[model samples]
Target: MSDRTPNPPSSQSRRLYQMTRGALIILPLSIAVVPWGILAGSLAVEAGLFDFQAQAVSALVFAGSVQLVGMGLIKAGATLSTLLLTTLFLTSRHLLYSATMRTRISHLPLHQRLLLGFLLTDELFAVSSHQTRKEFDFWYAFGAGFSFYLVWQLASLSGIVLGQSIPDLDQYGLDFAVAATFIAIVLPSVKKLSVLVTVIIALLLSVLFSVQGIEGGIILSSLIAMTIGYAISIVRKEPL
Candidate 1:
């Protein structure tokens, strides 16, 4: 053997490596969320939401789909109770997501845990979940989540600022970008036969519902498809 001493990595180098890896993992995925944020901000303004209300919706509310639906209901003159019920319905899935991650993050301080809850978007959760190595790295999760949070908030704010200038944003069909982004996210995960079947069923249901203009049908289809997938797994005696 050679007489050279092999030094382990420095603490600074390891921390930097983790942070960089975590941020890189989520940054690309966050591009999918940018259009939704812009659309939410611009639509809020066009829907006659006051500046402060829009801020509350984007900053405090933080759930993109829920906020969009809530803003639309508000614009349509829906009652406060109606908006509350609808938003709750739209975001009910978050309860399940939070519960799933509870054990993993239980060691974090209370404040950091609260922050994680706030930043736990679908994309963030997906990325962080796949990061098996960083499960216990609070700073790594923070780096990924905080970077995504900044992009979303800044994009929404920018859209709000530019909404007044571009009164005809709908004419550009920006919603298509958000739809395409979701498709891109889903397509990569269509590997297993069960997952493939579930996706096909969900797509068919979504198309039918969209053609019928059935409000909330997409969400309903998701629930139904997931249940079907679970039943399939049981029939195969496979764990989900």
Candidate 2:
């Protein structure tokens, strides 16, 4: 075992210097995400929030699915606890994302690490994992994540203003954007039956609990699904 860090190849360094690589890598997904952000903003506004509220949630939450779910819950006037639980559940996948990134990013300064954590989204994760790079550059990830973050905020702002003016943006079918984006994320990772089972179980449990009008159903379902998946992994000595 050696304490010294291995140097990345010169080609990897050259790839890092290619300023447009990260942007190019993220462009295709950004189109999907922008529509989803707009949908979230429009939905939030239609749910009776102030324009600032729509914009604030987009800027602060930054997780598209969680924002959409939170907007729905808010429209229903769900309890604060229910809202919290659902938001937590929606963002629970980030725990795994953060854990996976830790080995690559732990050497960074605390502030930089925090920024990356804040900017971590499904699209950014997909772009990062899909790209084949010999070494991880924080800037490369930052470029991809930052572009996504900026585009989403702008799209949300656009929708907020449009919702105020039109009040009929729902006909545009923007709701499909986030769901489509999710499929794009999962399709790449379903290389194993266990992984598929985990997804099915989570969805099934959530629906079952929702049908029963169970408070915190999303969280309960997600937690149980994760637990079952973990047990399966341990039994098989393989990751789901």
**lDDT by residue for model 2 over 1-240, one digit each (tens)?**
232336667556654654357666677677666667778889889889899988999989898878888888889999999999888877877887777777777789998788888988877776676443345667788888888888999989988888844334356565466466567766787666667778889889989998998866755776788788777778888842
How many clashes does each candidate structure show, in the order listed? 0, 0
Error of 2 at 112 (Å): 1.4
What lDDT, from 0 to 1, does candidate 2 have?
A: 0.76
Weakest 10 consecutive residues of candidate 1 by summed lDDT:
1-10
Steric clash pairs (candidate 2): none
Candidate 1: regions farther than 4 A off: 1-16, 47-53, 130-137, 166-192
TM-score of each: 0.74, 0.66
Q: Estimate every model's Cα lDDT from 0 to 1.
A: 0.74, 0.76
Estimate, for each residue in 20-80, the C-alpha lDDT of model 1 and write its tens digit.
7768777665665677777788878978987667766788888888877887888899999
- Clashing pairs for model 1 are none
Among all candidates shown, the one with the greatest lDDT: 2
